[model samples]
Target: MPADDGERGAAALAQMRAMTADICDVIPLTAEDDFRITTATMMIGNALLVDSRVTDLEYDRTPAHIARGGLDHFHVTLCIEGEMWFSSGRRDVMVRAGDICLLDMGPPNRTVLRGGGGRTHLRAIILQRAMLAPRLAHPDAATAILLPAQHPHARLLANHFAALMLPPAPEAGSAEVTIEAIADIAAAAAGGTADIAAGVERAERHLYLAVIKRRIADNLETDALTVDELCRHFQISRATLYRLFETDGGLAHYVREQRLNLAFRQLISPAARETRLIDMAVNMRFSSDSTFIRAFRRKFGLTPGELRELADRWLRETGAVPAIDTVLHQLARRRKS
Candidate 1:
């Protein structure tokens, strides 16, 4: 804390960001007059103990941040007073007072703190992955595991961090012992939570993606295949669905790619030689025939008509129908030539 009153908040913010540099990038979400933060950080070996209070702020962490920081530790945090909302790539968590949250610092995540104004107190013990990974049952699925306030293992761990946060710190030897005990209790509590919260979530995430994708592939003829419909049908938030296909650009992009691929296959089929272009567009969910032709040309280097004619010529010349994929491959080679 700075001796001058004017430097207090600014100094605190800078110090807090520097103290937790290994975790995430902290950005104050409130106005300067409304923003406030205070923190006490203690380091022992490769572990860190932090007690902090903030009015409101966002914790933004990404895979790139982890790579730059080079120390992605696991944080066992106890929300002593206030609330926290967290969303990692795969899980969303809401933590209330007395709840213990096990946050895997490895992945990309966003967290918002709410205390109604500087009343949110979070006491956390940060342990290096090397120190805790061996003890975890499912280390890969550990982020956003919220253990309720009354959970036995959670209560036990919470009580310890509470005592450690008080004045008159424990002796060096006692602190070392404390770290060992915290690690054991945390791994057990977190491992169990991960099994229920994260393990199933991991499998469920894959299942959800598969189900949503299959739905899109099968329903290209209807306008009901939009994101809004998918969300309502699956009873999932848009955020959850978007995260599922983030790497594929987005839900709309994935849908377009699937539609184009399906159209390509249908165009090459022997029975579809006489299919009308407008019908093909309507069946594939494009807004119009022109829209479908432009997109198909952009993606496959040939319009639907051009592709169909070429396929017909190839079949007539060879006296055999080429595989759908082989036709696409031939077009790609032609494009490069």
Candidate 2:
């Protein structure tokens, strides 16, 4: 659900502008404006809090309340509780209560709202360049595209964002976290490269990527493992593959780290207490013990033998243990230990 007109909606839009370093507008279609465009213009700058913006503009010439402007950020508009028509370049679009529209700020665009003899509320989110640049290298390249509001995940995220925009801000720390997660979710949902997981909760964008990470972790033991192999198996583009791992660390970095974590767990576990380090390396697909030692040292500032010794000491210090404490834990447990 999107916003309904009231002080709450107005305040939320105001707060959004203050918190996010950009401006947002919440407009309600008025009957008097029907058959007459109130305003239409182009937008500029970085807007990411909602959807993509592009450098194009068009209208149906079907007189109505119109909104088009230049914004220094990404602009997202949801035609909640009304009927609306839009033209982006040559493409004409119709928006209903559940249909959300994305406008590129750097491009010229126009929108017309046809009211059903009732007030129509629309929510627009404008995000700054500083806010979106880190997540995407070329954000503008994705501008001027309208993500269908029918997408379940996109609707879920849009609804959540709308809810957040309708309320007063929470405590500062919580609000900050919520805002970042909202941006990440919006970006992921609108990216349109893959499907968002089923049963996704509010503000858990990172959790979706965790699935990809776990997949990589599970396959680390294969001697021929590489990002290309993982990407192929997952059917994701190189950029998406890299983006999924970016928050965890970097893809190559995480692969090496998980491999080392597995090795460390294997070295001290009772099931592998007598397994030769060289053999362990071979089984773990380390091409050479020296290479393994170098990576281990670089990661943990200690040699493999030293880490194993430390793990043994830790195990001895803590008498109780799981059946498969390290590498086995990964295979058997669905969640991180």
Model 2: how far is 176 from its true place, Å?
A: 2.9
Candidate 1: residue pairs that collide:
55-118
For model 1, residues 1-337, the per-residue Cα lDDT tens digits are: 2112222466667877897687688888776556676677787567888887778789998777777767668888899888999998869899999899888877788999988755688888999888878768788887788789877556556645754554432121255555656666566666643534344444345445555665676676788778789887777788999998897799899888888988888887788988999999988878899999999999998889988988889899998888976887787788789
Give the TM-scores of the predictions, in the order they appear: 0.50, 0.37
Per-candidate clash tally: 1, 24
Leading candidate by TM-score: 1
lDDT of 2 by residue, 1-337 (tens): 2322322344443443354332223233332222221112222223223222211122322112123332445655666666666654565567777765555444444566555665454556666656744444345554545557766444644544444443332111243454455455555544522232231243454433443454555577874457787666545568866776676588787777778878866765667778887887777777888888898777656677875665666678777443434524433353343
The all-Cα superposition gives candidate 2 an RMSD in Å to the true structure of 15.0
lDDT of each: 0.75, 0.52
Off by over 4 Å in 2: 1-70, 90-92, 133-138, 166-173, 189-337
